[model samples]
Target: MADYVKDIRAKVGHMPLVMVGVGGAYIKDGKVLLQERADTGGWGLPGGYMEYGERVEETLKREFKEDAGLEILSYRFLTNFDQEFFTYPNGDQTQVLTPFYLVTAVKNQPAAFDKHETKAIAFFDFDHLPEIHFASHKKILAYLKTLL
Candidate 1:
């Protein structure tokens, strides 16, 4: 997938950029933090693209703090990811190459940001799932089950 993204960058010679994001488990007493993507109005792990000169870990920290409104202690690299393009109702595409990280947060029930891009945010358990924003994301959540 990395190769594919590199190929895209090389082929386009323009910023057909790859986007990465970090989603933490933030498990405390059996809960996980999630955010509803404003794009699809589905519950999803919080993450965004890797910024210029920024590390993957930094991206995770910033994204977690921004979307979940929490201070996180530490995180582990859970997986390297590739998700299919998501098309909006307007027919625009949000194509991305995603990196997922599982982090532990300092707070349990953190208050997330109320913003244009996030419709809702909360914690979800194993038995429950917020309407997932993308099909590939659901696979990521499913992969998480094996880790537990």
Candidate 2:
């Protein structure tokens, strides 16, 4: 409990500073890649917080590799955001993240491995997106409808 509090205190020190991230509709065969959060076991796109000393797009590229085991060809901004809220089953609270990206797969590829961050990674039809952890993801997908 003390550790979590200390971490929250340190994060708060970054004032008005929340996490920025990147994720996308990695579409193939008219379907998109989706992930289930290991912590919550709910569905979401594969992404994580932007790391220090890394370009935002680079973060997306790296996280795609780390979380979904895919290499991105090109990614453009879907939107920049300033909203997200979080809760943990163990009572840990966190600020939700603002994410950006409209990405597509590079080359004809097969699923590799993203061993730690994700347990399941697969493609799903847009109209049939599975029940996901984050409700915001459905909104994100709706936006993708405009793009694709």
Q: Best by lDDT, which number?
A: 2
Candidate 1 matches the true fold with a TM-score of: 0.74
TM-score of each candidate structure, all chains considered together:
0.74, 0.78
Q: Tally clashing residue pairs in candidate 2.
A: 1
Residue by residue across 1-148, what tens digits does model 1's lDDT show? Answer: 2344345556655433445544566655566667887766778877765666677777777777777677677777776767556655654455576777777546556466648657777778866876777777788778886777
Candidate 2 TM-score over all chains jointly: 0.78
Clashes of each: 0, 1
In lDDT terms, how accurate is model 2?
0.70
Indicate the worst ten consecutive residues by lDDT in candidate 1: 1-10
Q: Stretches of candidate 1 above 4 Å error?
A: 1-17, 107-114
lDDT of 2 by residue, 105-133 (tens): 46458756566677888889888888978
Return model 2's CA RMSD, one decimal: 4.6
Which runs in model 2 stand beyond 4 Å of their true positions? 1-17
Candidate 2: clashing pairs of residues:
43-133
Counting only residues 3 or more apart in sequence or on different chains, how many pairs clash (N, Cα, C under 3 Å) in candidate 1?
0
